[model samples]
Target chain A: MKKHIAVVSGDGIGPDIVREALKVLFAVGAKFGHTFTTSSYLAGGAALDAVGIPLPEETLDGCRNSDSVLLGAVGGPKWDTLASNLRPEKALLGLRGGLGLFCNLRPAILYKQLSDACPLKAEIIGEGLDLMVVRELTGGIYFGERGRTDDAAFDTMAYTVGEIERIVRKAFEIAQKRSKRLCSVDKANILNTSQLWREVVKRVQGDYPDVEVSHLYVDNAAMQLVRNPRQFDVIVTENMFGDILSDEASQITGSIGMLPSASLREDSYGMYEPIHGSAPDIAGKDLANPIATILSVAMMLRYSFGLQAEADCIESAVSKVLDNGYRTADIHTPGMKKIGTNDMGSLIAQSL
Target chain B: MKKHIAVVSGDGIGPDIVREALKVLFAVGAKFGHTFTTSSYLAGGAALDAVGIPLPEETLDGCRNSDSVLLGAVGGPKWDTLASNLRPEKALLGLRGGLGLFCNLRPAILYKQLSDACPLKAEIIGEGLDLMVVRELTGGIYFGERGRTDDAAFDTMAYTVGEIERIVRKAFEIAQKRSKRLCSVDKANILNTSQLWREVVKRVQGDYPDVEVSHLYVDNAAMQLVRNPRQFDVIVTENMFGDILSDEASQITGSIGMLPSASLREDSYGMYEPIHGSAPDIAGKDLANPIATILSVAMMLRYSFGLQAEADCIESAVSKVLDNGYRTADIHTPGMKKIGTNDMGSLIAQSL
Candidate 1:
């Protein structure tokens, strides 16, 4: 198999982490007998520095032309003073919008090796926590019409049947592949958008009768996430509710630095990245964790490339490394051997 | 001082819990040398049963005429099949709107005696969690324009300058009274209403210079609530965000059964109630937890009647009862002396 990968190593430790991820990806390709070609694209603060914009047209074109996109992290204090639209973070919004990435998959998994970092009690965590938050990225309040007048300001939270249907269907499909349980969360009792969301999800439920479906008010869902996170499998919700709930879910894991996320379009094309921001303070120090970025490569393989076995191998490598007490600075314990970012990536690749 | 109190003992364990709270209130009044006159009003499921509406005109008038109102839990499964407007839950909304209660104060306090009930690990719940969420209750998306078309549905999240001002002022004043630290939660980076909310809060900060203020996006705030709940003092946000966050905050305490909330208007007139619902299963079984309702009475005295000392006495007395290992069935643990609702309330009253 031959694949073209677009690499957007944005800023600070982004380049360092992406470099390690690329090494691991190349190692996987070599071991699995796959041909992978990569093209570099300037984006985020890097683009703003090289060019005048956060997301150059050439960079977006490069990503669109590629089979899949691999991003590290974006934004830092250096670009914080820029206008909102010109800020380094705008590159992320621009790419997602330009690529039509509607579904964002954020998996919050508390590995048993890192269970000591979990904020929840042992009883609440049960046998470790692993849940995916399927967030609708393109629609809902985030993209709604918003304006401010002299005395008042308003934002319209609107959703169409098509928007809700697609996201719910994607969530159902993901659930079908996982535990066959999906919980669609919305404030159906109050918001008209949520009511319609529920209606659309219920309508879509007929297509996948094998997957069990449940509905919860957003508020109750937030509470349930903290009270019993282990009960959830796949949580689907609108953009705003998803934003809040996913962040809440990630925090409970107590290992935010090790989480990976995937933003996918209608097709198999997706952009995979680590959930953590660029650590400018530790940039070039080899102190950053590369496991998240490596796992992101694994997600790209499974979701975008359809290489399930390859993805599983990479994931198992990660688990095995952690089981062997190989820790990065972010997840280091007293007895664990603390390895550099490059070393950690190499360790996982070697294990594979 | 002579005060008029409207008591709304709605449904299920509502009447029982209110009875216990009344006992504590009267005890406080007797000890503080304050004269209190009470009037009973029907609302929620009880009103729906007696009259055709969940919130009757007579009940609204009674609540309006009183200096303050004390309410137990409302709504039960019996009224679940009623029309949207006729539902027992609608009574709470109707009262808030009719009474012009704009600011809702939800205190998520994890009592030291009940630390074992907290879902978070010992380190995360340092010194016990105690924070207040000041939510703008009568406005924002819940009361804003909402409609469902054939293909799309929308809800308008709008906030006027005056609306934001009043709520921010209320929150700041509360923060001044408590920890003097206010964290304003909003999606300012995304939504117009939140942007306006942030502006109004910053402007209001000038009036309360002594109070420390910080801002967090709603998503980050949700994460921080789980990561380190002790970092927050007073979290002020719009209605929908508040609804989700306060519930999340309460769940971390692991004792939702013992939380109280207050809804206030411009003046000292406020309505207080337990955050829990009407548990119809235990309606007249003497198994209800009255601590939340009793705490609501404490809030009523502090906010409405301005009886600080009296409120302190009531709070301390309730704490003493818990310290003595007396618990209601809902919050009872092993080795704790579980008492009936009436007995628990009487014990706190006697201590007062």
Candidate 2:
């Protein structure tokens, strides 16, 4: 396979981590008879500092031309005082919106070797956790009409039939790929947005006849995620609710540095990234963890480029490295050796 | 002091549990130099069966006439098919709305003895979880404009400055009574409703000069709740977020059956109940936990009747019974005796 992957080493430790992710990708390619062409681009705070804009035209062009895109963490306190439209995080919203990345897949998986690092009990973290959250990427309250006045403020959570249908269809398809169990979460009892969401999801359910479908109130789903996450397979929800729940789900996996996510449009191209933010506090300190970014590359290969064998190779290498107790500062266990960012990335590449 | 308490033994195990709560109230009354006048009312499914409506005219009359109201669990599957206006859950909402109960207080407290039952690790669970979530009960998305259309649907998350001011003031007052720490949670980074919410909360902070105030985006706050719950003292948020977070917080106490909540108006009158709904599956089976309902009666005494000593007596009895390993079916641990609902309620009252 020959693939062109656009790389956005965003801000803070992004540059260093992306270097390691690229290194791993090259090493995997050399060993697996695959060829990857890498192209670097500007994004987030770094882009703003260089060109007075977060997502530069050249950067979007680079991603649009690639087979897949890999982004490191973006945004930080440095951009906190910037105007809302100019802030580094706005770049993320722009890229997702511009690319029509409607399906955001955030899988919260607990690696058996890292179970001890989880905040949850051993019993609750039993066996291993595997659940994918399919969040509608570009719609809902996140991009809905919002306004404020001197006395009152409003934000509309709006969903069109077409929007709901596509997201629910993607959810059922993901369920078909996994355990064939789908849970559509909403607040149907109260919100009409939710009522329509439920109705549309039910309509989509008929198409995926082999998949088992269930519905849960968003509140109850949040509670159940903590109470027993094992019960879920493929969970789908609206953008804002998914934003919160997906983050909560990330925490269950022990370290945000170990989680990766994919934002995709229907064109078989996607953006992959670690589900972490720019850690300015530890930036330039060589303390960042690169596993999440490396794992993101793995997802790019499998989901975007359709190089399944190469992706599995990278995933297994990550598992083996964890099995051998190689730990980064964030996921360090009592007896595990804590290595710096580059060293951890090098170890995973070596394992690959 | 003489206090008149209106007790609404709702449905399912409501009557059985209220029998014990009343006994505890009487026991506390006997210990303190207080006299109590009790009145009973019908509500929930029981009320529908007896009076043809969930909240009958007589029940509302009783609630209006009493100093405070103590309600047992309400709603179950039996009323699932009832007309929306006559559903048992509506009775609970009607009571809150009719009484102008705008501030809903749900305290998440983890008894030292019950910490082992929590899903999160002991270190994350921390010493004792004692944060009070003061949720705005009557505003925000919960009561916002909602509807469905042929091709789309929407719900407005709306908030008025006056509404936020009152709720924030109530939260600050509650924080002043607690550890003097308050966290105002919202999605100010994304939603206009939250931006106004943040601004209003900040403006209201001037009134509470002595209390420490902090702002957290709701997504970050949700993650923080699981990562480090002990960091919070008093959390205030809009309705929908509060409903979800409060339930999540309650689960950290091990069993949902152990959490009590109160919906109050500024006049000091409130409707008290456990956060758990009626368990129709075990409704008549005597398997429900009554400690939460019993503890709610304690809150009614303290916050409504101003009988602090009586409330203390009830609380100490609950603590003492739990200290002696009195486990209700819902919170049963290995080797702990699983007592029936009535037995557990009676045991706590007897301890009082």
Candidate 3:
């Protein structure tokens, strides 16, 4: 198989972590007998430094021409003073919009080796939690019309049948691959948009007859996430609820530094990245964790490249490294052998 | 001090719990040399059963004539089949609207004796969790205009300067009484209403110069609640955000049966109730936990009746009862003295 990968190593530790991820990817390519070509594109603060824009048109074109995009973390205090539209984070929004990415997949997996870091009690965690949050990335209140008058301000939360149908179908498909359980959360009892969301979810359930579906009010859903996170398989919600819930779910795992995320459009074209932000403080210090970025390459293999075996191999290598007691600075324990970013990457690649 | 209280014990365990709370209230009245007049009103499922409507005009009239209202849980499976307008929960909504109650106070308190029930790690819950959520109840998406087209549905989340000012002032006053720190939660970076909310909160801060104010986005706030709940003193947000966050905060305590809430209007006039619902399964079986209702009585005394010492006495008595290992069926554990609703209430009142 042959694939073209666009790499956007944005700023700070972003370049370092992305380098490690590329090392692991190349190792996987060699072992799995695949030909992979990579193109480095300037974006975020890196682009702003070279050019006067956060997201250069040339970079977006490069990503568009590639099979899939792999992004390192973006933004830091260096670009915080810029205008909102010109800020480093705007590059992310620009890419999502330009690529038509509508679904964000955030998986919160509490590894057995890291169970001690979980905020929840052992009894409540109950054999560890591994659930995916399928968030509708490009719609809902975030994209809705908003304005302010002299005395009042308003924001519209609107949803169309088409938007709901696609996200629901994606969630169901994801659920079908996992535990066959999909919990669709919304404030149906109160919001008209949520009522329509529920209606469309039920309509889409017919397409995936094997997937079991359930609905919970947003408030109750938030409570349930803390009360029994183990009960969820694939939880899906609109943009704002997902933003809130996905963050909550990630925090409960107590290992944000080790999590990977994917934002995808309708096709297999997706951008995978680590959920953590670029640590400018640790930049060039080789102290950053690259596991999240490395695991993101695994997600790209499974979701974008459709290489299940290759994805499994990368994941297994990560587990093997952890089993051998190798740890990055962020997740290092007392008895663990703490390694720098490059060593962690090389170790996982060597395991592969 | 003379006080007129309107008691509406709705359905299921509502009557049982309200009776116990009234028992405690009367005991306080007798011990504190206060003249307390009580009138029982029909509302919720009781009103629906008696007059085929959830909120009878007479009940609203009774609440209006009284200084404050004390309500038990409302709704049950029996009334689930009723029309939306006639549902038992409608009674509470109607009272809030008719009485012009715009501020909701939900306190998530983790008792030291009940700390074992909390789901969060001890470090995260240091010194026991005690935070208040001051929610703007009467406005925002819940009351905003909502409608559906053939292919799309939308709900408006709007907030007026007056609305934001009143809630912020109420929160500041409450914060002034407690920690003097108020954290206003909003999606200010995205939504226009939240931007206006943040603006209003800042404008109101000048009025309360002694109170410290901070801001947090709703998503980060949700994560922070699970990560470090102790960092919050009083959190204020719009209706929808509050509805979700307050529930999450309460669940962290792992003692929903022991939580009480207050809905207040402009003045000291307010309606106090337990945050729990009518447990149809436990109705009339003497299995209900009366602590939440009794605590609601304590809130009423503090917020409405201006009887701080009396409220303190009631709170102290409840804590003393818990310290003595007297547990209701809801919060019961091995080796604890398990008691029924009536006995638990009597014990608390006796301690008072």
| Whole-model lDDT per candidate | 0.93, 0.87, 0.93
True contacts kept of each: 0.97, 0.79, 0.95
Q: How do the residues B249-348 of candidate 1 rate in per-residue lDDT, one tens digit apiece?
A: 9998999988999999999999999999889999888899999999999999999888899999988998999999999888889999999988998999
DockQ winner among the candidates? Answer: 1
**Over the stretch B1-352, how does candidate 2's per-residue lDDT look in tens digits?**
8879888888877776777778778877777768888899998999899888999878888898888898988887888898889999888888988888999999998888788878889878667788899999999888988777798998888999998888899899889978999999998888899989998988888888999999988878778877788999999999998988888788767767788889988878999998887777776777778888888988888778777777788888888988888898778899777788778877887887
**What are the per-candidate TM-scores when only chain A is compared?**
0.98, 0.98, 0.99
DockQ, each predicted model: 0.91, 0.79, 0.90
| B81: Cα error in model 2, Å | 1.7
Error of 3 at A63 (Å): 1.6
For candidate 1, give the lDDT.
0.93
Alpha carbon deviation, residue A202, candidate 3 (Å) = 1.6
Residue B136 alpha-carbon offset, candidate 2, angstroms: 1.2
TM-score of predicted model 2? Answer: 0.97
TM-score, cand. 3:
0.98
Q: Scored by Cα lDDT, where does model 2 land? A: 0.87
Let me know the DockQ for model 2. Answer: 0.79
Cα error, residue B2 of model 1, in Å, equals 0.9
